[model samples]
Target: MLKHDYKVRTGNNQYEGFLVDLIKEVANMLNFQYDIYLVHDGKFGSKKADGNWNGMIGELISGNATLALGLLSITSQREEAVDFTKPFMIRYITVLMKVTKSTTSYFEFLNPLHPFVWFCTIGALLFVIIVLYVLERIGNINRTDYPSISFKECFWFVFGSLLHGSTDASPSTLSGRILTASWWFFALILILSYTANLTAFLSVKTINTPIKTVTDLASQTRIKYGTVKSSGTSGFLKNTDIEHFAKMWAQMSEIEPSSMVDTSEVGFKKVKEGNYAFIWDTTVNKYKTIEDCDLMEIGPPFDPQGLGISVPTGATYTEEFSMAILKLNDTGRISEMERKWWVHRNCPDYSNPSTDKTSGLQIENVAGVFFILVGGVAIAAVLCLGDYIAKRILKSVKKEKVHAISPEGDDI
Candidate 1:
């Protein structure tokens, strides 16, 4: 229904090739005819008289394109100028503090109690608690009163659903038995598959390679870390600080090659220098400077964050594109793309990740939670059973006492 013309802007030329490939893929998938407009010098589009901010805004105000995609951040100015698609990739930002900063700086990033860490830890804990709760309820149910059980039994139901077992907890009910038997085949298949995958991924008999931390870089007799120029990284700014310069002046320290290199040259020089680290994203690799450097993220994104696409403000397509992304997410295709692009190569190997490990893990994690709930219910049922047995024994003894009392009364 529409003609596609890409209006792109970027500071780096190395990304041109990757962008071309990406555009081709988009073109193949898009039903509309499209043309590529590469503005090599960080220019917005042809609307820009000189590729400046005023021109870019004027283009959007004038309705130049249907959608604009770039390495742009969703800042207030941009938000005012255009509508953004939900960010597909979350990017983390981090401080480039020297390993020595742990001792020198007041910030306590190492503590596990840090707020971000707490969020992740607490989330995992809650998931476990919820699962255990459901499991406990499911395990305690009797067939006769299955319908009257608490709503928490839904957790048990989901567990049963995943396991391909009957959702009913009533052991004596024929309906429950039939449902259980019907689900068994599916339940066993999911369980065995997950178990095998988990075993394969988690098994590690030897620590052949020593794990390295960001701190280790500073201890080395030679230490150099590379970051993109003008990046938000605070450590890069600190590297140029007067205090560091003063230290060099006082110590009569030898000049490090990294200390001499510029931002453009940092990626090229750091890898050749032993004990040096490069900090750049796989996204930046769309540019050429990182082609030679053996780059590793100093660690998993010191801060995870995201980038997004934008449409001109008030464009009707905004909601349509937003809905499309959501639909992709609901269908699990978004996660599939994420694994294919981000996780598969970048993250440690997950179970069967090469094909569809993300969906599998998500399914397992979900199932694990349900099973935990079932286990909780099972424990509760055992306690209930013990109480039932005790009550029966007590009643029998009471009857004997009553009979003895009646005989004594008759004799009297």
Candidate 2:
């Protein structure tokens, strides 16, 4: 339904225009047709092709296309020009500076209570509150639906579940039953898993690092913290402070004002040059480089947070995309994409990182069995409940029929 041009860097340094391929895939899935134009690779090209939104503004303003795709940083200023989707990738602006001083490490500054972690925590809490309030409202309106549960009760119910609660909401309504049995159960598990992982990330201590926090930058004896001039300098690397670098590397793959110098030899050239700090993203595997620079991540990796495709503000498309994304999450498409393009770069050697974390219980092995047991129990419950209601209705109907047919067969 729309014509668009797009480009991304290939494994080689050369730019590969793949607009047609993306169009084919998305169009087939969306059941629509569109014209795709091959745009220049933004990573290595003219200034216009750079990640900056200004250069591409001309195309959008001139009616060249309806939308532009790629790593277009969507900010409040640029948001006026074109709408952006939620971030498809999460990265942190980091300083690939040398560790000049041995005394100070970057780990001290990154605490668990940092704004990023708090934001996620608060967000989870708010979501729990909103869901509980909504459930409470529905429960209040219908007596047969969760009759005994109040808003406060439901709030604590979700709270306990998020922290560590047994699966007991005391919900009495069919709606509540269906909701918990379907959506909430899976949602809770995912949220908890990510939360746990994040907690572990924050707690990790770097064995040897001098600087700890952003404030300690001035005090950092020998290291110099810097980022790409385009992206914010201090703010990007502030959270990464030495300790969290590895965790950041594990979760993110792309970054703005990326330090990825060149795809050839994995940007090792810049690192080889001394005193020059390259602001690049950390990947799962280290690229062996012949460049003069050694790849030293100054601190923990931080979340740079970039533009993703989302519906316009106040548009239902946003919700639709979010719902679809959730479904994709259920199907593992989102994770698979990350593993393919971002993590492994489509390498077969790259295994599912999440699967490596499983301990006592393997979800894949037990999930089907668990579902079967649950399905049997649910079917049995439904049958028993249906039979009881059916018998009650049948008995009432028979009584009315008998009364109507009494004696002379006159209508009652």
Candidate 3:
């Protein structure tokens, strides 16, 4: 209908389409001859601000065409102007976008857990270290059997337990041991949860599209989105009372001519160039995606409608046409036509098979853990250096005091 060289037209000026085939079948059954031609404006029709119609709806109303075929969506507004047959195809408005390659993020390993979860984990680790230090100090006040645990050693023990690493420190008293056991169990559960989630997060190739739904497209500015101008999709957007659609229409109006395209083919080309999404009939979108593997449809239908033949208002043949279309549906001929047009394409399926299976965790998947480990080691090194310098200063002060008391630097 949009003048596709292969699907809609052949080199010899012959026409072909699922809707065309269905219309031919219906004509044969009804014993009527009809001529087919494209709408002069090449539009599905929309009520302009001046209250005039254009495209196929216009053609039908003005008696230029007996009936309009192609992907003419049934709508309440269009119904007011022209009569329509029972829908031959159920269609909905959906977003069409180019299938983008999955790119790696520097912090991709952190994706498994939310940032808040990571913050809480760090806070919990520090809290556990403080609790262990306090418990060990209290136990050491009465017991003389083992050396008292220092704050530094307590920190090291908790950090090592969380990482499932070896540590030099151990709890001597019963209270300290009990606390350590609880911390160890907690760490075990945390590790298991992180590992399981990381596996799934890494295996799935994340598609980072800002526009998943019509609402998403309306809400975002980074991705430019629109529909074919003077088409049913644009008409729906302009007329819808829904808040998001209303906002989107306003935005589209601000952009004017560029935001609205003349055809879905042009919209598809814009999508291929990136940062753009085309909102169009789901049936056409599906056919386009099948024909071009680089394209994909996003989200469920925004507006549920049906594709039907358009005829003049109160046309005498309306009942006969509707009944013929219903008969085609009853006999499964419509489904057969859909299979032939929509599914029987020669395009390659662009989905990656490796992405479907659970892949072994790569170093990048666990890179955050390694970064944390390196950071911990660095902090411990700094603390160790400070502690050594402080101890040395204290020892020097004591030696000087002894020397001053002994009246010389005499050995004890």
Candidate 4:
């Protein structure tokens, strides 16, 4: 109820907001004068230890006000003390948090895979390299065509093949070739998975948020969170039969300074200060996100309930007020009023973003990695040609010496 639906005090003690406008429209239709005021105790109303109601509900129960015009949630408990008109708005609880920018350092390119995944991949590569090297040595012992491979050459051969590049360390024996073929298959699959995943990381701007649902928040303790003290959210947590909400209540109860705050703005301020999340209505959270780019709604809305104009129980005018609201809705006046107050204003261009296409990875995005592969292939080819040339020169030199010698004397 502390959302923008509350009356905003202005000069001459007048008030404005969605609530103020709503009351005005109701008055014009019913042809009655209504004076707007805020509740003295500044509460949404909850049963205290002494067993008496307080806040706007108390104001109505004590005959201090006729109709509660703010965003009062209609509940069975509140209904016992006060009556509600047909709901003018529907809302639900949600989490609000500071917009933490994901890190964009040069090394962020490594984020496509988790640290554990990378560890396992490197371990597999190392294990395969040792197996291939041992197989080559075994082939040599059997007097096969396989040449003895040094650890340095093995490293280049494995890493270069993993990148889909040529290397001078090609195996000749059947066992060595089979082992190399298996590694090639593994490398192909790993490459395809990495490329498919990396496209999302490189193409779209994404927020690296770990908490995406109430279950996530309930499971974690590093981020402190709480609802407005005596709020419907607090009451819901206390009364909910769900286990996840129960755990959240226990955490909020033991938190330092009591995570329960007095107002939505105060709870929002905690979020702005960092490391704190405000549990409140999504309607209010959405409005705040629009005004401040640093704020965002983390999870989907839950516990849907209607926001209605509240009245004291057995009030004579209850039916009339409900009818007036119904008429306003039918005529689209309510929708018009919502757009008048809810549309984005003064928020910068980036605040209202369009659904732009997420482009795929361009050649320039990975040109450097391609160049590395090309350079390795070039060097390996050159070394292979040099070995072949050196062998041919040695063979020809021996032939020339033999031919130059006389047939009988064998002297050059």
Residue pairs in steric clash, candidate 4? Answer: none
lDDT of 4 by residue, 104-146 (tens): 4444456678999899999988998888888888777866445
User: Which segments of candidate 4 are over 4 A away from where they belong?
Assistant: 1-14, 107-200, 255-257, 298-300, 343-412
Worst 10 residues of 2 by lDDT: 284-293
Q: In TM-score terms, which candidate is top?
A: 4
- RMSD in angstroms, all models? 24.7, 27.4, 9.4, 8.9
TM-score of 1: 0.35
CA lDDT, candidate 4, residue 386 = 99
Pairwise lDDT winner, candidates 2 and 3: 3
Candidate 1 global CA lDDT score = 0.45
Error of 1 at 361 (Å): 37
Candidate 3 lDDT, 346-371, residue by residue in tens: 54333332234334667766677788
**Model 2, span 1-412: residue lDDT tens:** 1223223433222323222233344445556655434343322111234454433443554455554554345555456655555554455544343333223223322332466865876686667656656765666684653356666676676666555576455566556656555446655665666667545443332233344333344343243333333332222444345554433322223332343233322333444554434444443112221111233454345455564552333444454444454555567666665544333122211112122222243353235546767889999999999999999999999998898784987776
**Model 1: how far residue 300 lies from native, Å:** 4.1
Off by over 4 Å in 1: 1-31, 42-66, 76-81, 93-211, 215-221, 230-276, 282-295, 342-412
Model 2: lDDT equals 0.45
lDDT of 1 by residue, 241-276 (tens): 445333432222244433433343455454444444
